[model samples]
Target: MKRRPRRSVPATLTAVVLLAACAFVAVAAIQPIVGETPWVSYRSVADALHGARWTDLVPAIAGGVAALLGLVLLLTAILPGKLTVLPLLGELDSGASRRSYRSTLRAAVSTVDGVSAAKVKLKRRKVSVKVTTGRTSTGGLADAVRGALERRLDQIVPAVRPAVKVKVHAVRSAS
Candidate 1:
């Protein structure tokens, strides 16, 4: 079976094309009146191009295109009802805070049986942990890591119930 090629239209390009098409249609529809007008009749398209009068239309055309693009982007942004930049801002502003929290959580979870090291990632409402275990069976190590992390979070942030996720990496034989 031949697979169909996926088609994608970039929002910016779509906005520009749509706006330019509308402008062209509008100009075409009014062409007869424009030709009849004294001002337009006096200045032909050749004269406009030669004298660089088309330069004057540049700003208006650019403005219309920008407005259309802005409208498309604004609608796309608002329709989703999610903050696009806030989480990025938080990551930038609170790097140290989050890193410290992660380290502390990692230390606590690493104390659990069979866990050799723990890596913690704390997002807005949840904590994810990757546990390096000293035991071949990762199931018990994952459970222990999750339990420790949840207990630590409950002690620190009582108002928030952090969802714990545990992944095991590099299981070793317990000596």
Candidate 2:
């Protein structure tokens, strides 16, 4: 399934507040405007700047808040995310979650003939695969799993394909 990007919590909250403010203004002014006496005046950004003073307590607090907000935005933009959202076919973002991508990878690895089973783990920038197969086929099977997943990843997440690592182990049997 394709995933749609979600606006963050802050963004959603901002939208809600703006919508409420607009609605309140419209309701409050509707009667006055209909009676030919407009009741509200809008503040411009320039007005705020004109009133701002460095020594003023309110403006100083407001400026500090603005600076903190900017810092948060900068950090989030500069740092890499734990797991990247993969772009889907013809879509900007996938509707599926990271776990879905892991499952898809697990399926791809299991398709190999000798791979008895497969486990997939997704890390910050890597995908690790552990497969179980006979001792004699360990090396080749591990290589095959890695190769197959690498190709599948190209289709699943074309952007920033995480490094794929595969390991094989023989299942123990009680003698």
Candidate 3:
């Protein structure tokens, strides 16, 4: 089974910190509104726990939760997936034909001199490749994969641009 890439600890922590900051900002933004509402008030932590109506607290809590979720999504956009897999999205055709195309591309790329493994998916005219190369120069491997993919794509799907939407996953050897 293929394993997804592992996220760096600092990146994960940074995401958490950003989410917390977003939540803080959201809560701060909403605090004045909560204060204006008759149901909610700012009291000591002890008082808030004891007798504050659930209705009053719920909205603010919900807002905080929503903010946190939004921040999480924002962070997700910034961070790469943990696995060495690329998700192909957009107007590509579905069913076995696409899968076959992906598999064919993967096979072709894997046969290249330095590539150890390859996974491919197509979306619209774009092809996404996640390739692990045995070569030490990840950048060169990526370029080679792109070049090979373009050649194959010209023969298979001539309408697509070789450069426009090729998502390349370049893996480096651990020294």
Candidate 4:
């Protein structure tokens, strides 16, 4: 069984924009037919569209904006987003929430020696570890943190193993 990533937020936003535009146009059209003042004049809109030439600046700008929007929407639909739930190594099809996974990895990293604080960020196929320590020297700390993270990951036994990248920062010693 394959787990699918969450829907693209840009795609959702695009859908919402399209829905709002359609609703606005429908309301404007219906108000004129129902003997009410429309927010936008349908006749004026038709005249503006008909009178505007493709070579005019206004029409050219509008066309460029529309084309850009379309391209963004197309890319959003085509790209795969980050997974909300990661697959676990189990026979019964179990999974773990991404938040929990990150927290677990953070805890494991924080337990390492000389690591004062740790932050873990999980991307599509990578784990970023940022560590802060007060030891003044950060040599080998990143590698140690990476090792701890890998050990924790091995214990958790997720179906896929992501590459780990660790960054360490050392605080000034109060000597």
Candidate 5:
């Protein structure tokens, strides 16, 4: 089974929070109509809004939050999904996941001469590989890894083309 990509964070959180708020609004609206109910904390909304200074401040803060939430939701809805995978050439149906991309990059770096281990992190515009190189010549590992990655990327053209950066940390010889 194929898993769907997740929606934006603010959109998901805002939807859940707004649904909870609706329940509160429903109870608040019906409180005044429910005669002789102990839950009737206020005589009317006017009294609730007119009294304490905190009441006005609370609503103002809530309004600000609500406005920001609304703006984010609109933007997320209008914007296209951020694609992290590269598609197979001439085959739109076949694509690679970002996780697999990072894994392959790590494998590529680890295979390079003098590289004892490697860790790769994929960002929007850059692929960062941190490697522990053994007590051997390490001048060309970075270039080798970068070349391999570029070749891999050329093979599978992703939506975003990120530059590669390799950081080689020398492993200390244990006495």
Candidate 6:
């Protein structure tokens, strides 16, 4: 089973804003009945809205903004989010987060001889490994790092194996 991401942040903010607006309207409507001053001057607001012409610049701008906001909310609700988990191979259903996957690959590359540090970047179709080593000559180091990375990938067995590309950076000696 594939796992899909969620638009929680946008949905949450939108819900909060709507709730606040509704609560404000409810309070404003109830204030006069209870003989209390409303937070907003409802009469002025009503007069301004009623008096404004449809073709007025302020009304037109407000209408455009509302339409744009509605469009954004609609699109967010309808669009499918990007996949957060990468599916793994095998009968049992399983997946790994991108962060963990990249770290695992980085660990594999770092374990190779002469590798001081490693950075792994995972993309849809490629895994880029950057290795930093103190060794002056980096001949054949890239290939070794790539091999270790591929070995780790084989062990994990992700459904879609991204191609591994290795780059070795030689750190200069302090002397």
Pitting candidate 3 against candidate 4, the one with the higher lDDT is 4
lDDT string for model 2 (151-172, tens) is 8977765555578888887785
Could you tell me the C-alpha RMSD of candidate 1 in Å? 14.7
Cα distance off (Å), candidate 4, residue 106? 0.5
Candidate that scores best on lDDT: 6
Stretches off by above 4 angstroms in model 5 are 1-5, 27-37, 50-59, 91-93, 154-161, 173-175
Using Cα atoms with residue i matched to residue i, what is each candidate's TM-score against the true structure?
0.44, 0.48, 0.39, 0.81, 0.69, 0.83
Q: Which residues of candidate 2, in runs, are more than 4 Å off?
A: 1-91, 172-175
Q: Per-residue lDDT of 68-128 in model 3, one digit per residue for the tens?
A: 9778867766765533433333356422344566676787787778777776766544567
Candidate 3's TM-score: 0.39
- Displacement of residue 150 (Cα, Å) in model 2 is 1.4
lDDT, each prediction: 0.64, 0.73, 0.62, 0.86, 0.72, 0.88
Q: Tell how far residue 44 is off in model 6, in angstroms.
A: 0.9
Model 6, which residues run further than 4 Å from truth? 173-175
Model 1 lDDT at residue 151: 83
lDDT of 1 by residue, 48-106 (tens): 65766435877679779899978876676555331122222222332124455677788
- What lDDT is reached at residue 36 by model 1? 46
- Which should have the higher TM-score, number 4 or number 5? 4
lDDT tens string, model 6, 1-175?
4677788888899989999999989999899999998888978998998999988999899999999999998898898765678899999999998888888888888789999998888877799988999998889999999889889999999998899888889998545
| Model 6 weakest lDDT span, ten residues long | 77-86
RMSD of each: 14.7, 8.9, 13.8, 2.6, 4.5, 2.5
Clashes of each: 0, 3, 5, 0, 0, 0
- The CA lDDT at 60 in model 3 is 80
